[model samples]
Target: MTVNIDKLTITTPAATSSTNLVALELSGAQAIERFPQYVTVLSDGSVKLTAPTKGASSKSTHRTRCEWSEPTNWTLASAADHWNRQRMTVTKVNSAQKVVISQIHVRGDDSPPVKVFWNKGNITMGFRTKYNQTTPVNSTVLKGVPLGAEFTVSIHATSKGVVTVEAKCNGVSGSSGALQLDATWGTRLFEFHGGVYNQVDYTNSTPAADGSICVISDLSLSHS
Candidate 1:
């Protein structure tokens, strides 16, 4: 059995260099690489991730985030069931009141099959139907999710590469139905991520308090 939290790394809003962002790796010796301010594991086994809107970020991207990612990689056909399920509460939001909470990231680029967002009080998602789809199709998954209220979000995909995502807030539920993936995604390696990723780009004058924060009460990842 694998401990879900033990198999991941935290990608912070801190920059590594002029061209890259830092990844606080959690492993053997790299366990020492963690930063409490950005990624904190509470005594109750929950995790708190913070991303200041004006913090350091990659040169290529304008936003910032503090997200936990599965260290290893896998293709869509790697397992019959590949999923990321998390119980999270957004305690804070950026100036734009929008932030990405989960994603299905493709290994070599910014392109991803899924980008789940907490837009204001609505749970929205962007689905990229094909590998080369420049822009994902966006839709609202759920609405009226209040800040600081716990909610569950799940993104699942099977060996066939068909994806499904859903959200539950205050006993209300919404789903993405079934998002079909193209053959171009067959050989692409992917990973699951969840946490506070600020969607709005930060500028030098942006207030430090203009940030996003999320507390994850439970997270479960499985592939079979």
Candidate 2:
């Protein structure tokens, strides 16, 4: 399906902010406020997100991104009654560092309960129900793909709050079985995000001259 650029929103770090924690949304009325620095849309319709080595502050020196979201907000009550799906590929990862490439988040939640990551030389998909849990959903690691390689990842949420995750790379694929959502998430809204979210801090040290660049293509979101 063709994606509607007008309905998509791009978020990145703000240029001038004291807290160094504000994000600039590119699309809404705020689009005119400041031009996006880390996120950009290519002429071919793909999205690219860059994470600088050093950011606004030490607390978090990186940027978070979402490819797109469903127009209508959804909650657990609507579970079993509605569905949300997201798909994207990791076209190019400039570095071998770990990065959050996608997530399924509940509104108001500081962090997404479900996240997909590119770690070292492998792909890891994890999930959590608690805000303070240190461990993620236990699962086997999926082999990594090289540059120009394509990986299709998707998630399907049922009306009963059951979430299913699937991924495909080089003709091999696997599933997360069924992940039961926490009851606490029942009343909260949820959405899908796809793009690079650097997991490292570059403050007071130097790892790579160029932080990292994550390119995602064939991004599409749909719900019913």
Candidate 3:
């Protein structure tokens, strides 16, 4: 049997605005067979959540959802040797703007081609688009990757005749990018997006008894 105790105190009005300040206490016998137990507080002040269980060597985790208002702008930074997937977007647009995203990957799979897109949604096959008159803007393709290596994907677009952009992760057929080029709004962008399909093999045509693994991460979005 395993047992542990954990407590949390929320100290903001916005954190408890939605829910009625419930003190969650989870106590159980074992980790693999334990369920989350809930408790409530009736005071007008802060709420304290406590959990105490029998035995030892038990692993317990806690998480809380929160919401707050910012001053229309905020800066976010990620440390080295960190991996997190994200999609960036700016609600307002301005001139001479550029969205620069950079990350230092400590250790990750680099053999497969990681596809990137200019906007939201999953990677779509058999898609193409034209940027400007200089050349027919087509789907951008990330070249081969050396296994157990580090690299970066950068895009520089301007409001000056820049049309569309697309990126596909582990793609081999057709192209990936802007689904449509006739849309308005001169918003420049860059993003890292991906999806997963369970398969026995990445390039095998025959069905197998198991499924494959796919993970897409590190997405940044902005406009210039």
lDDT against the true structure, each candidate: 0.84, 0.58, 0.22
Q: What digit string (tens of lDDT, one per residue) describes model 3 on residues 175-224?
A: 33323333221232222222211111112232222211111123333442
lDDT, candidate 1, 1-224, per-residue tens: 12245547776776665665543334311332446677666677677778999877665677888888888999988899999999999999998999999999998888798999999898999988889689989999998998999999999999898899999988999998988888989999999999888999877789878999998998888899
Which pairs clash (backbone N, Cα, C closer than 3 Å) in model 1? none
User: Which candidate would rank higher by lDDT, 1 or 3?
Assistant: 1
Q: Kindly report which residue stretches of model 1 are placed more than 4 angstroms away from their true locations once superposed.
A: 1-4, 17-34
TM-score of model 2 (CA atoms): 0.76
Task: Order the candidates by TM-score, highest first.
Answer: 1, 2, 3
Worst 10 residues of 3 by lDDT: 65-74
Best by lDDT: 1
Better of 1 and 2 by TM-score: 1
Angstrom error of the Cα, residue 17, model 3: value is 30
List candidate 2 segments past 4 Å from native: 1-5, 16-21, 28-37, 57-72, 79-96, 130-134
Candidate 2 per-residue lDDT over residues 89-160, each given as its tens digit: 544443436667767766765556678776665667788766435677756446765544667767677667
For residue 157, give model 2's deviation from the true position in Å. 1.4
Pairing residues by index, what is the TM-score of model 1?
Answer: 0.91
Task: Provide the lDDT at 64 for model 1.
Answer: 88
Ranking the candidates on lDDT from highest down gives: 1, 2, 3
